[model samples]
Target: MTATLDHTAAPLIRRPAGRPLRQLVVPYLYVLPAALFVAAFLLYPMVLTAWRSLTHFDGISDPTFAGLDNFRDLFADPHFLLSLRNTVIWTVAAVIFPVTLGLVFALAFSRVRWGGFFKTVIYLPATISAAAAGILFSFVFNYDNGILNMILRGIGLSGLASRWLFDVPTNTFAMIATYTWQQTGLNMMLFLVGLQGLPPEPIEAAKIEGCTGWNLVRRIILPMLMPYVVITTLLAIVNGFKVFDLIWVMTQGGPGRASETLAVTMYREGFILFKQGYSAAIAVVISVVALAFSYFYLRSVLEQEARQ
Candidate 1:
């Protein structure tokens, strides 16, 4: 009887020696490849860019230490200042128009018949590449003959139609409008998702308390959709800061660089003029600005969450 008890206890006590070690290390083993990839690709490039920004490297020549000269020159250049101004305009317009229009469209679609079809139609532009949309709008805004001009002439509003991409503020606003058309659809879909996922109790209760129409939306629905609003608005701001493909394809930051944003300026300096170090400085500045925006957004979100 003692031997039988000892044998049973031995079976329970003698676990596989390697089992716990394998369990501890397996997850890290699985994650190692991705970590290595990020270090090699993402982290290494970022470090290299930062170092290069402090040196004078024109791609072909040996890099020489320049210590803030590139940044100093950047601030002094009128074109760079203009680029900064244009970037600000892009960020503001992108946020206001896309987010607002998206919310409006989402609300309208939620109420209307054939809403799904209308949504599909509106979302069609988002399926098109930014470059393609840029090219399409370039023709639409052509000086001599474009659909927009033709329609304006037909409606006796031809005076309002001018050189859309040639003027300073008009060119900037034209690009903003094009961006809005492309972006609003995605925002609408996101808001619609938020609306559909909302719990019925608050809305039902609001209705029971005689809340209706704009008041209901303003007080109850909008507050509930805060998460989606944060996401969409942040995305719009980031995209605006990074806008390059559309500007490149449409205006090529043309008419003497009047419409150049920082991204465009960076590309023209680095690739076109071969000012590698200056371009790196511009890239670093852009990254810092984008991070600042993200940080503020995250802070605001956390504050809201805490308050709730």
Candidate 2:
């Protein structure tokens, strides 16, 4: 009876209060604020935009449900088709030119003396705002008295000095050149950072194996740098698709809309023409395209990693 009474009086062997519960809850609590913020801002806006794409509203008027009409109209619209073509061209150019040039310069800079000075000089262009770069290039591409034309005349290549921003294809290419000049710096910096963080032991070992200069790079270095290359190329492509400010400041989708990209067309539709629903549709399309590419890229990387 005394033993039974002592057992009854003793503390209950229940799980300790608070500790395990807090361990489970505290982590979620730490993440709650960020989750709420993303839900409110990004997720909510995305859902609302998708809804808006299915409706027709003139900003102030009550939105009318239009189902898939907006998407159908988008496909039928010739201007949108042209803009898509331009977007493709820009994406291709951005991925190829800037990434390649940046890689070349980064490798060269990594091996050179006074690399910091050269890096600063090369990366300076990235500091300039897109608008400023566009404005600067406008003057550089000016027809008759422009520095580019003057240089061409000086160097006996005057035939190559046609109105850079006047023709359709030429204007688009000229704009791309301007973007490449600015974007190269960013890609170069990214590559440079990757180059700096590389494990030096492998490189040193390769040197012992008579792998010097290009041989070292082609064999040991390039494979390791593949991740950076992929990232740089992806960013360049995305930026190219989303390019607006620079193109707007430079071409304004001019030369008879030859240089118009999807972003330009979307802006013209939504703001200039006040087709809110149409614009939302365009936004959805752009988002879809970007997301599709991003998803595929990440999936590919994951698959490749898993295989390795």
Candidate 3:
């Protein structure tokens, strides 16, 4: 009996020795493919762009070192400044509208029957390619023979129908509205997921304590869903900054650069004007801005999660 007990004990001791190795190896294997993809796609392009930003290539001749001249020119360019302002406006409006409407939709859907069907319909836009959506909105917002103008004329609001893409304020708002329509559904889905995951015990307790209506949402639901809100808002901001296809298809940054975003500017400079170095500089700036925003956003999320 003593010999048999010793043999079993030996295997148990050996099992513990292999556990730590298996744990470490399994996680590393799972992450290996993702790490390779990031290195190949994201990191490589970033490094190459930074290098190109310092040179004058124009995609034909050998690149010559230009130091910081490209950046200097970018800062002084009036068109670039306009693009920057447009980008900021786009980011702010995009984040605000999508997140706000998403929260509203999430709340409504969470409490209603047949909500899944409505949710699917709302999320449908997110499945459409941005280029296709842009083309669709182009017809909708066309100044002459457009659906919007036709509807306005029918409703006796013909006076309000004007060249939307030509006017700065209206054009900007029009583009932002299109983006909001597509993005709100995604935000709604995120919030819905967050809402569903919330602890029911607290919600029931709050209801029992007469925490009804706005109080229930404001104090109970919103707090629990803060993490989701932050994630979706950051995503909206990034997408807004990177907006190109819609603006490209609808306005072509046209009627006179009214709708030109950084991405559009980059495309025009690099591909259209063949100013590859200058375009690379703009691309570098965009990448930097995106990275900075992501870092801060992630940090805030981490801190919030820790506190919770």
Q: Considering every candidate listed, which one attains the maximal TM-score? A: 1
Ranking of all candidate structures by their TM-score, best first: 1, 3, 2
Per-residue lDDT of 306 in model 2: 72
Ranking by lDDT: 1, 2, 3
For residues 1-308, could you state the per-residue lDDT of candidate 3 as single tens digits? 99999998987777444567788799999999999999999999888889999999789999999999999999899999999999999999988898899989989988789988999888899899888888888788898988999999999999999877778778888888888888888899888988888989989999999999999999998888888888788877888888999889888897688679899999999999999999999999898888887887788678766866
Tens-digit lDDT track of model 2 for 141-252: 9998888999999999988888889888999999999999998989999899879878899999999989999999999999988877877777777788889999999989
lDDT of 3: 0.88
Lowest lDDT 10-residue stretch of candidate 2: 299-308
TM-score: model 2 vs. ground truth: 0.86
lDDT over C-alpha atoms for residue 103 of model 1: 97
At residue 158, give the lDDT of candidate 2.
Answer: 86
Best candidate per lDDT, number?
1
- lDDT over C-alpha atoms for residue 208 of model 2: 96
128 in model 1: Cα distance from truth in Å?
A: 1.0
Reference-based TM-score, model 3:
0.86
The C-alpha stretches of model 2 lying farther than 4 A from their native spots are 1-15, 19-37, 296-308
139-220, model 1: which lDDT tens digit per residue? 9998789778878988999898889998887988889999999998999998998898888999999999999999999999
The models' CA-based lDDT, in order, is 0.91, 0.89, 0.88
Q: For model 3, give the RMSD to the true fold.
A: 3.9
What C-alpha lDDT does candidate 1 achieve relative to the native structure?
A: 0.91
Where does candidate 1 stray beyond 4 Å? 1-3, 20-33, 294-308
TM-score of 1: 0.90
